[model samples]
Target chain A: MPLRHLAPMLAALLALAVQAAPGNGDSGTQPEDRSHLPQLGDPYLPPAARKPAQRPPLAGAALQAQARAKLQQRFAAADTLKTGSISLAQAKAAGLGYVVQHFAEIDRQGSGRVSFEQVVSHQQGAR
Target chain B: MPVSLKRTHSYLLAITLALAACGGGGGGGSTPTQPTQPGNPADRGFSDPLAYSSSGNASLSVANEGAALTHHSLNLGGRVIDYTATAGHLIASHPQTSQPKAAFFYVAYTAKNQDVRTRPVTFFYNGGPGSASVWLHLGSYGPKRLQVGYPATSQPQPFPLVDNQESLLDTSDLVFVDAIGAGLSQAIAPHTNQTFWGVDADAEAFRDFVTRYLAVNQRTASPKFILGESYGGVRSSVLADLLEAAGTRMNGVILLSPILNYYSNCAVYSPGEANCTGFLPTYANTGAHFRLTNPAQTDYAAYAQQMRSYAASTYGPAVASWLGSRLPPSNSLVDQLVGLTGARANLWQANLSLHPNTYQFQLITGTVLGRYDARVTAPQGSALASEGDPSSTFITSSFASTIRSYLTSQLKYTAQTSYAISSNAIQSWNWQHDGQDLPDTLPDLAAALQQNPNLKIMVLHGYNDLATPFHQTELDLARLGNVPGLRIHNYEGGHMMYLDDASRVRTKADLVTFYASALN
Candidate 1:
């Protein structure tokens, strides 16, 4: 996200925090309250509450599995030609947004192309 | 709440659109083979939703979504005013194609025994490219208001639903319009809610709706006005021009705490020049209100005005000079800034800009100021992040519940579909307008003014609004050159100035005068 948009996004998230609060008992259940719109039917409700931030991080095999799977998915999407690797330009063109930000770090060998394993190693090393 | 939150959604949408586009291939000139389907069945070939096909059935028409009309009387200071409230949807078709698009919802209160041609009608909408019109409908000028005490969280419901003595009904007829996907509004099948989620497309949708409204109600000749708050200001600007170009002349346009140019905003995501010049006055205004800064400056409004002058003459030039040179600004400049904004001298010394978040956080120790209304504050539980604006959180549920109750018992309009206070369509809003990367609707507003020489414009802003600072609006309007018919009003409230009792009454009074003058 652009720095200009960060404040507004934080503001929005904060507003969402309020909207997600439990209702004030009136879920429009009254027989005469036929005009009330139900909260359950609201399409804009947040998909799900975020996982607790303090939860223990995945480690060992579980971490590796998750990291490998994520890298594979991203690499496959970016490497549209099925070349098993992608150039920085390819990654950018593919809209690998945040990944593109770390393209140089991932392609540490400076060969101009990064493999899925390279990305996974980069993630694991960073972690 | 709606405006701020939905903006984040629209930014996400912009990225989504970019990613979606990246997956698509470039041009294909050759047409070698025909598809299985010869043509699109859903294509109406530029026909209005209300227009019948050769084999016509009224029941199947998209525009056949009927209205629920309820008669009501509101006593404003012992003067009983009888009115008819019509709640329903108007199908807004594509401007060029005329294909049925979205069914835009609206609730209009027309005073009894008024001449359709002479009586002024104002269309009101709240900002939140994603928000419903309920804020203005129930929380502001609708005959019924959700009672909220200034600077205090509304008590648990049943929240008081009282007659708004400050309602403009006595002066002009009111029509509250919900943007597509908000409230009961939704896109007709074949077209999704995102169809009308961009700057131009959204304005076009509202233009179509307003025109259709006039035609349907046989009030095309009536004196018309538009009142849009927050992002609605951008809509009103574009919509005004669109309506005028289509020959629907508007008598007036009212913008409340509007952000006219996105590129000049202080919170732009892109790295650029730190342009906090416009926000200085608001920061000072808020600080003064809270008695954190300029405590000796008893008159907050006058102090804010003085700060505007200081910003123009001293602070703005000093920042420009600092940006031009590597040398830090003079100590005197830093002291003046620190004194006015109550921000740390180090913050001003580091960068001549004070972001609203930083100011909101630092204005009062252990108390985070509300972004919408600085007067409202909450305990700073964590230094890392804000829970939400106390102003927004306090009244949202109260207003939402009250509107739903009013709709059900008073307006007699009900539906199985929830009246979405806001939509997620902002998650995919197309921000491109006039072939530009970002929208700047001042040109559109100026064009409208040029087109209709008699068109009157009123801008209302609050002193403590951090989202769209009142000074920013002043700067934007100054760029419009000399506009004789344009009027600006500032009050002691925030973005929704009507949330404050005194500001609400003052705003209504000003609006009443505006309507009378515009009609004349």
Candidate 2:
């Protein structure tokens, strides 16, 4: 980032020291009442919440493992994998974006639902 | 401030330079075979996820992939300053479901080493709800602009991007945003275009983007302003009020050739029709500029001013009375209209109520004046109503092509998606908002200004522009009951008047003065 953009980040960090109090309900809370947020269903919503200070996505092996765990927790743990696939709602609740992310890789047959083995393989191949 | 921060800045600059050098093989593009760098920022490289500070909201994840950042130095207003230009995407998700929505493309410029609270950052938008920010980005005062000489000024071609000393960067940072369908911005997955294809939806999206940008950038405490052109001028009024209501306060707004009310500019007069004589003065000014007016006067400003006064006093009333079947044939009024607009005296006398389009065509019969700036004219090329705009003929590809080249060759923002300077979003755009006031943004503007009396507004217009005539805006503002800091300035050129050297210089002076006034 350039210094011109840096000043604000620095200022926010300083402000965050005071403003991020529990009472302020600062944006750190995951999945808050976003219904109240402007431009509902806005395709660009992710960036809307991306303040200067954010925790970037998990990358590499960590990301792969997390994806697998999230899938397993949302699918296999719920026995949805017994049907050899999971629904779109299952994928979303797991914090996985279907069309935009690697959901297609796991859904090997081009079907919306992915087989349990395919999900495992997809995570394994994510290096 | 911190030594570590300084070191990181140097490191980032070094990496940015190296990346730029790696793509230096981009030749002066002539043929497709030697294809120079493309303008898609996505082709640059997938970037590290933008991580918020670990201390606050560390869980927020933003994958603005392919975002490119680079630094450039320019001597603006007699001072050499290094500034950074960034090309990136802003992602959107469903507010309730947190389902990923789409990516909004944008480019931003900021002067290095400055306190932002008092000084401000301006987000710029070009008119067509579907228009890209490229025009103002490379055309006006956005750090770097094109040298494609506009008509009535210089010869065309040799569109090179150079450091614009007139850029507002010396005063404030700038971020040019592409409305959803324009430029590289788009709707993702199941979200579809309809999700953001309307007025309320568009305003909310833009408002969210501004809020998110400020929050993410940690500029929540900084002063913010919006600069919108054309339809974006109307957008600025709604944005000013919406953003402020959404917890983001604006210090000022700059409207360029703003169309405050649609009925005023392009209204069709009929039974119960409001006499929109706003285009009269502009028709006369356009006539004056082209030396088409009969019994023409050499003094342009004086003649325009006189016509403006007559538009409301005599011309407007005459048309309104004619609509009521109460108007009488007035010979001197016809002569004045003929002298001011260069139209045949009989056209004015025979038909007291002149339509905006016919009035435009009659000014230089058979040749239509450009809808953007009447000062321009071309061979009446087509009979198609769709292709009627004459001034738009040059600016369309001129702005898009130059911006693409500048971004690719100069900033190294490359992607597979071709840059679109403008799109047909206007055709599909849902113009309906909460307020059914199509022709007047004054209520919303007044609402905002009333809430923040300290907020200043600078309305700039090119006198020769017939599209969003300056006189119409003058009449519109006149009815808005005592706005404290609203000042309108008229210039010699047409819409996008900054294309002229003199206009650009004068416009910048006014801007510098405005920004300075706000700072104090």
Candidate 3:
């Protein structure tokens, strides 16, 4: 068992915690049904009714704005030295759980870090 | 499945061979030991005694002296008659001495009707207690063969045929045998069906087949070889031991994507874990292939070195902890250790455990590149949730069509029924509860190599195969303790190394050189 292999299962565990959050109800359950859902198998999930997430639906512009704001917030929180650009260690500190959880989804290079361009692309994709 | 004429003839041949081998009592062991002579008191000629009344669209041509086909029937304990197909030019006289209750085999020699003294004999069989020797016969080695696409595909029709340019018959004489119930081989009378079904029984039967073939052919002096695939790898290992016990030694043993260990390789109980371990190297390799990890790091040797270090130290602990609880501050030390292995960001984000499926899906989705190799992606699913394997899609599809076509069109052998090209025959296989129990054939193989120093073993693996990871094979071979002059090679392919163009060429070359070396 290598660290590279543990990454996904760890992400899944973190994703499980996010699912347990009350307002994020459908975020966890709905994605499970999505074709892009993780394939760890059905045994991990209990056979109970799943409540959906309760996030507000934002339109194209609003979504883009929200994504940018979130990205900025993450960068600021991760940049302990107050440096404009967030370093790899800075990103890990901001939200190691969140970053590791969504790294593959965001880091298109699969290098496991968010570059400025990658962050911008992610924000645009959300729109 | 309609009974095809060709299949019916092949079945007849199998039944005849089975009956001839298992028929007689104590005295039948006295059959002469000559290379070309027929030893069975009942072996009349090249044609089947149980003739078919119907005529076919294709005509059967009897080639003159050097090219005619010889036929025989062997009884393997079952009353059912089994037949065998052999080239006439290959048969030689039987030896003077014979063992009692030995299994009979048909030998097909190459070298243009040359004496058995001149050419080496290679014994070949496919795995499947129920499978016939068709794949090796038509796909790779047998002289006359059926061709399919280079990578192989299911038959377009029920039957498709092609000419095989890679056949090994040009190099060594081949003897294609059907297990007791497969092909044209069968059991005769008195001996129960149970005699040739189980593990030990099967080994005994094959041992008998080789000894009988050697005695009848009178070529005990020539180099002998055994080539098997999949489960046949297990069979060959056991047979290597059995052959030694029966006083015959093998010069070389060739295993094509062999399954030598079941515990580490085939036990799919822990899907996520099993696949993760198996596919890790493949991912590193794939990443290296696409320059995803680092373009400068091209070869797998360097990749494997990094991965091995990660797996043994930080990677192992990170996965263990993640599966249970958060690691202490020292655990972060493990993460830092992982960072040193390259791909620091990736290792940290994975929190250290990368499931096989996640790696597979991530590689494709993140990189926009698909990994056709299963060995790299096979173990990515949840251990308890996913069905068998995602990789089986390509493997089964590719082998099915080509096998169907080759059997029907080229060999002109058909069955009134459908043959199982591959199956879960070992689904019920249980590991020995005792720690000392042997889970695979490595023990027998090691013993054989130890007893006969001249015996050589060659293992070929597809780097992309997750089914039986090349690493697991490497690990097991190392554990065998007896470090003979063994050669192991990796092809950039899957479990079936021959499916890849590059692998097939390298494999053929390696095998030819191996055989040549063994004989000298």
Candidate 4:
């Protein structure tokens, strides 16, 4: 369960930066994802099918620990700017702002930084 | 719990949020967990197996009428789900002559596991009034997807596609549909697309396609679901009503980043108009994403929740009073609008209220935030923000070419007609249907819900999408006032939320849960 929670988040923050695809827009709300796609044509030869992209083969159970380790690395990297805590500017620039923003949301005591344990505790309560 | 705060915990908390979304448990409820599927390279097809000429874009006239089927398997939910991929045509013929004229195209994936009769079937499509199904197909739900580009990153050419781990094949069979004049589907000799391009007519055509598909596939007894994104979301609502009336009752309807109300989503509404207020929370969310908001605004979710409440209860009403000077405008109101929108109070006063378009460019002084995903910005794009969606451009660049590779190479569904992902059909579309309900689909949704109390609807939105902001959906749903079977879930991404790896996982789980809850 913990693994389930960590995988997508760690992946999403990185993935939102990646965009590829064709013809996905809608009128009014259409993504305009379709606007720039190159048109298709070639009468004789069949277009070679593309391979499907994939996440690493790690199971959900491994994702929790994997995610935690990756996060510590991220924090360590950001710590170069400021030890123990990443500044708001650092967080935004690193594209880790969503994490900081959410922590602040549940950081009820008005404390600048929210601890992992507090988040766990609060989440348990919220659930 | 330790009260000590650390910035690192923000990352941990994100995991929790993602987990909350994933924890809905998308596993097939009744189908016992089969042994974990072993990894098979061939099952997923060759890596970068698709290749196409780069001299120019592919032609749009080559289409084959043949129904192409390919067998495949993917490792999903820890199980190897074997399935059939069919790229087929649903021909629309003259009712009197019974002669085929035009053809509607679809790509379907039916899992080899479980009884075909009882397993759920979900039809997926994108909205363009004239768009193909490739967006939702490869972008979100299908097993294959073109490489997605990151913000500001140019996609590597010879666009590569990859196996989609987040494919919804875990709980339901998928059929991605393309409308007439899009993809391989087009108008026929006996029948012209002129009749099929309107709102009502389009709905009827889709209805008949589903009916014919079910009859041909012999899946009339399966649990049915309709999923449409963007304009497709609007279409999904109308399609729901049409399908039910056609005696094809669906168990559920799923709308992704849906725009249920056109007026509320767009237009120059008077200051404090409902539509203007709807953009408030989205504006804040985008601000937080880009760190444009006050640094003191730490908690993004809490901020958005508070904003939603204000928008629905207080701010929305306060803004509406500006119409005709019915209620004298107050400084406090302007200050509140400024506070909520993060733009200058003077700007708010000048405009009477902050519109999404005005704020789109204003939030960040130089670049424009994408309409599909407000968090992403492009300095060179049109400031109007209406020229096209920047975020979507990044996606289509990859998908447009990749699908051709998929259809021709993978599915072997060759056609003499060229594939049109985004079609010109929208240009000729007839919008004059029923004035009683302008362009909004909320009325259709309400009636559909009433007609079938058993029907379930799940409206989803991307947190970053300004085009169909999550908060606007909240406002619309609130107006609907808690119908029994309708639920709303917002993922942490833009219009095509699934493009974001995290949102894709979260959405797959959400869709799976919706299917299970509604169908089971």
The residue-by-residue lDDT of candidate 2 on B175-239, one tens digit each, is 89887766766655455545676666776678767765565455666678899888787788777
TM-score of every model versus the real structure: 0.70, 0.68, 0.56, 0.68
Q: For every candidate, what share of the true interface contacts is present?
A: 0.00, 0.00, 0.01, 0.00
RMSD of each: 20.4, 22.0, 24.8, 23.7
Candidate 1 vs candidate 2: which has greater lDDT? 1
lDDT of 3: 0.47
Candidate 1, residue B328: how far the Cα is off, in Å = 3.8
TM-score of structure candidate 1: 0.70
What lDDT tens digits, residue by residue, belong to model 3 across residues B1-520?
1212223554444434323322222122232322332343333334333211111111112111111233332222342222223421111111222212212223353333334454677888776444555566655655433333323333343333333344455556677765544443433223323335445666667776676566644557667888886667777887886575344767888876666755444223322232234445655665555455643456666666676666566455555665454332255554453333223344334334443333334443322111234432232233211233333332333345665553443233343333344222232222231122323566567656643567888888776654455665776676654455588877776655664555666777888888777876
Best by lDDT: 1
Worst 10 residues of 4 chain B by lDDT: B46-55
lDDT per model vs. reference: 0.65, 0.59, 0.47, 0.58
**Order of models, best TM-score first:** 1, 2, 4, 3
lDDT tens digits, residue span B404-518, model 1: 6677666666665556777655445576765455566666776666546688999999988877788888887776667888999999988778989989999988988888889
**Per-residue lDDT for A1-127 in model 3, tens only?**
9876665556656534433333223112222222111111111111121212133223334433543454355456666766554545555554333333445676766554465445444433551
* lDDT (10s digit) by residue, model 2, range A50-82: 222123223334433443443344356434446
